[model samples]
Target: MNNFKTESFDLNRAFLLDSSHPPSSIVTKLHPLNKIMAEGQIHEDIPLLVMELDNQAIAFITPQLAYQHIVQGVLNGQAWLVSFCSICNGGAVFSPLVDDEVYSFQEGGFYDAMVLLYDVQSGSYWDHLTGNCLYGSLVGKELKRLSNLLHMSLRQVLAAYPDALLALSALPEQQQTEAEEDEAWRKASEPEWSKGLVKTLGVEDNRLPRLNMGLGVWTETTRRYYPVAQLYAMNNVLIDMVDGQRLITYIDPLSGTPGAFFTDASQAEWQHNILQLNNGDSMRDMVIFDANMMLKRPQRPFQLFVRWYSFALKFPNCEIYGQPVNTQG
Candidate 1:
């Protein structure tokens, strides 16, 4: 029930390819088998934000690339912003258009404990979560969000779209090297909560550790948090009611990221760790399933995966699941 505008931003700039090191498209050389092998060598447990464009799948979007605000062009002259904040474990994909002009975003340091994004077009800062232009020419403008993003493992993505193209394989050699260096630097600067690494401006919740990962969902009047550890303890799936909507949340046991969907259907039963719906449909991957039992096409009531601390800082009134209830009489 969040009362927000859903107007589509004008796409003046069709693409935002890095000027000095333009990305090369290798669709002809992309094969599922080969890309899967390369991804396995890097890390099978790492998740990728997978999207389908013009019947071709765009995969191999690592968290490192997201943290770097790497904008890549896909089919139909559309560009995608793969954004991730390492400090808060916040990951989201957005269309890079603000107003009529397409903008390229880079890490613009931090503002109020949240990552601020700087656009090359207007030199404005934007809030990554809300997509609001905080400063510069396009102030108060918001970015449009793309739908049906499969934030799951590369293996699951390849299995779902066997013919999906590997976008990372097309990245320039020098850019690839720079991406590796950025990841290394990030790892070396792990947040230390004891030293006040994560700061919250307002009241705080002490229900869980500040650094734990939490999947957050916000409605117009309510906000909810699902801690990763609690989801794992609940057999990797939690069916709950939020803001009068019934939601089924699934957490990949291997990757630990959560994806949720709305379904009036009963709780899905698991056999051999595979989710089986009442209509005889079975799912082996972490992609959200719709009411029709189709995978990768998540229905209404989507959720955002982020760190517990970030959720608390952004939505302090959010209800935390799995907190111990008082039983003493």
Candidate 2:
């Protein structure tokens, strides 16, 4: 046998829709409950036993891979993340069972590390898990700690069945109103290849390269964060934060946007091209406001490069696609 070494198993490559992408033969089966994830509502409600292909450990990360970039830091012992706001009572719901498994703080903190966002505009970064003091660097420092807590290496449980979900309440009032507005706006902007955003969530096809950021699907309520996404869901790039960068991951031969003037060919190649565009740009003074905070409705992504990009600051420096281009196109 050829000696091939794979450190970690790719969840996406393994969950291929068809046989086009060769199977690794190592299949993990989940129960109907654990495997429950509908596109219409992108809910990241389960705790994923993430580990490497063999017995190597990753961490107890919720299947929510989009919106938030969870690297599992040292201080954050077995934590859960969501976009909910407990005080507002209008945020998304965090898996209480999963939360019980994670650690909590005493510096006047909420037991709920991951708060759901019923109101995307009112979301506060400092209150969220991303800004937690535990995370130091992006490297795998925290992920390693989270992995050590699990007993049966994730690999062993790979082919096992799924699990169950706990009782979770709905988002509060102010949050619901915002969510509806966000939903209304999402439906307004329809992608050329598919229907509007709302419809796309319900229609599941490998057509869109997707990743679930604990926030579930892109609801009108949470569409504000969609502009700065890092993952995919429903084949559409959910969290695209390319303020001064370009947007292109890999080439989806079928859905690939040509190197046109309005849309560059560069976006068709690289996945997070936005990162490349703003290679040396500093995010110190950068301020990202909710697009709908003023409109009171959901709208298309900030693709056309809104006027906010033109804001003038004292030492504001920016770039895109690796080169220094106009922040406001």
Q: Kindly give the stretch of ten consecutive residues in candidate 2 with the minimal lDDT sum.
A: 306-315
Per residue, candidate 1 scores C-alpha lDDT tens digits across 152-231 of 67667766677766555444677777766655543432454422233322334666766677688766775778887778
Model 1 accuracy (lDDT, Cα)? 0.59
Q: Global lDDT of each model?
A: 0.59, 0.22
Over the stretch 8-122, how does candidate 2's per-residue lDDT look in tens digits? Answer: 2122222111223221111122223333343323234232323221232233322222212122222122233233221211121122122134332111222222221111121
Candidate 2 TM-score, C-alpha based = 0.24
Find the candidate with the highest lDDT and give its number.
1
Question: CA shift at 233, candidate 2, in angstroms?
Answer: 22
Worst 10 residues of 1 by lDDT: 9-18
TM, every model: 0.72, 0.24
Measured on C-alpha atoms, candidate 2 has an lDDT of 0.22
